[model samples]
Target: MQNRSLRADDWAAEALRKYSDMVYRLAYAQVRNRTDADDIFQEVFIRLVKSSPEFESDEHMKAWLIRVTVNCSKTMWLSSWKKRMVFWEDKDLNRIPAEEAPAGNEALEEALDSLPVKMRRVIHLFYYEEMSVDEIAEALSEKPSTIRSQLTRARKLLRKKLIGEEAKRRVQG
Candidate 1:
């Protein structure tokens, strides 16, 4: 809804107020740290304001935001990961961490943060959002087949990595 897009004066304030938690959480989920997530969140909104994207629908806006978050997360990690050696530096900065998270949630988040950027974004969008591959494709500006293929590959990778970790834990136990 173009009407929902922010006016010149209201753009930054409105976007930050409405989507800050969501964008921060999504970025943190990908990066798994406070500093990186905050950086990604800021970058995502900055890109939104600068680009002035005329979102086609709510879904379109969400997709674009997620896409930008994913990219910012990747850039943060790729360039500054070495500088950010501290563990979970941004824990206090998060606004949302799902108070009653499910079992093995931390492990899942650990595994998720280890995934490559593209695969992680797709998995997050699909599983967290309960979005279909076609819907994900529409959101990401990707083809349905590509989303399906990426999901398949991401699943296989997660299974392999998680299972291997489990097996290693059992062996150590």
Candidate 2:
């Protein structure tokens, strides 16, 4: 029993090491705040330890983490404490970490940040995490068609925001 416990502990640590960045990034993408994202990140791994779920494979584990992260973000948003707290429209609080963002991507990042949270999640999963529409739907508990529609709408919004509609039309023409 002791040996099993130790093995589980080790496995949990390894999983944290392997998936921490992905978890944090996903959380940050959803919450749009570093502090809340950090809280979500910790909550996710704590749940993992508490549940001690056995995954069939790495992909299964990744999927589980994504689902949990999304759920946690939702819970955070719905929490009474979150509801009561007021946030100032502070640009610094909402900007992505400089190191994580690539050079000349600030405009794009700003455009992404302007998106609604739901659109941001789909965009992050599809573009950053490279998850398929079906996978994002499964993780987000939405239908594939919904995920596809969100992705399409998100892209259009981003395009319109990043480059004016006139520029898009001129490019196409």
Candidate 3:
């Protein structure tokens, strides 16, 4: 029994090490605030520790983490505490860590930040995480068609926003 418990602990530690960044990015993508994202990250790990649900495979474990992170972010988004708190200034647009972003990629980051949460999630999972549409749909609890549609819409919106921003800069310069 003790050995089994130790094995579980070891497995959890490995899981955290492997998936922490993915979970944090997913949380950040949803909430768009560093503080909220941090909270969601902690909550997701806490749930994982508490539940100790058996996963049939690594993919299943990943899907579970993504779903939990998303649900936690959604809960935080709709929380009364979150609703009541008001900060007048927008957070700095660079919530993503500097090291994670390539130099001269601010335009792309801004375009991504401009997207709606669902669009951002789909984009991140598909492009950044390199997950397939079906995998993303499974993780997000949406249909594959819905994931595809969101990806299409997100791309169009990004293109329009980026082009408009560039045009404005050109006119000003």
Candidate 4:
């Protein structure tokens, strides 16, 4: 498969064209910052270009990219662990503002960011990417049961947080 002679440049360009947003969104879901998301975005493609293993299918390609993006994001997070306090203080969304952000978007994003990395990744893939449970399990290299469990847990946590915030707001009012 490695001998199939895929040009790195061509592959890189195609990947960026077809999946750049997907890659960036995945990274953003992890690190929650533009600069680090961009870094992880670049690193995902770099690893794809330089790595020796050949992908078995487009699904394989997608899984590889997602896995690499997750790892690169984790690396950036660990390296910048000290910078996290600054992250909290900044209170900015990593994504470009959409034309219309639905109500509760910020609160939901905040809840998502508050989740553990594993749960965050699973929830992101399940909802943001609109991936099925099987697809998310493949991308995450986890069992379908694990993905389902993580999604359920994330839902419960987010519901609790949002409800708590609403109660606090009412109390203050």
lDDT of each: 0.75, 0.86, 0.86, 0.79
lDDT of 2 at 171: 93
Tens digits of per-residue lDDT, candidate 3, 1-173, equal 35444354488888888999999988888777688888999999989989999999998999999999989988887886744366546455437677876897777778987898889988888887899999999898899999999999999999999998899889999
**Model 4 steric clash pairs:** none
Rank the candidate models, highest TM-score first. Answer: 3, 2, 4, 1
Q: What is the C-alpha lDDT profile of model 1 across 8-53, one tens digit per residue?
A: 6675576677778878877866776676677788889889978989
lDDT of 3: 0.86
Q: Once all C-alphas are superposed, what RMSD does model 4 give against the true structure?
A: 4.0
Candidate 4, residues 1-173, lDDT tens digits: the string is 35544466566567767788989988878777687888988888878778845878777778788888888877887776554667564656555465455765777767877888888888789888899999888877789998999999999999998888788879999
Query: Which stretches in model 1 have alpha-carbon errors above 4 Å?
Result: 1-12, 77-103
Candidate 3, which segments miss by more than 4 Å at Cα? 1-9, 83-86, 93-101
Q: Given candidate 2, what's the lDDT at residue 31?
A: 82
Model 2 over residues 1-173: C-alpha lDDT tens digits?
A: 35444354488888998999999999989888787888899999999989989999998899999999999998888876744366666546546678877887776767877898899999999999999999999877899999999999999999988886457657989
TM-score of 4: 0.79
Candidate 2 residues lying further than 4 Å off, grouped into runs, are: 3-9, 80-86, 89-91, 97-101, 165-173
- Ordered from best to worst lDDT, the candidate numbers read 2, 3, 4, 1
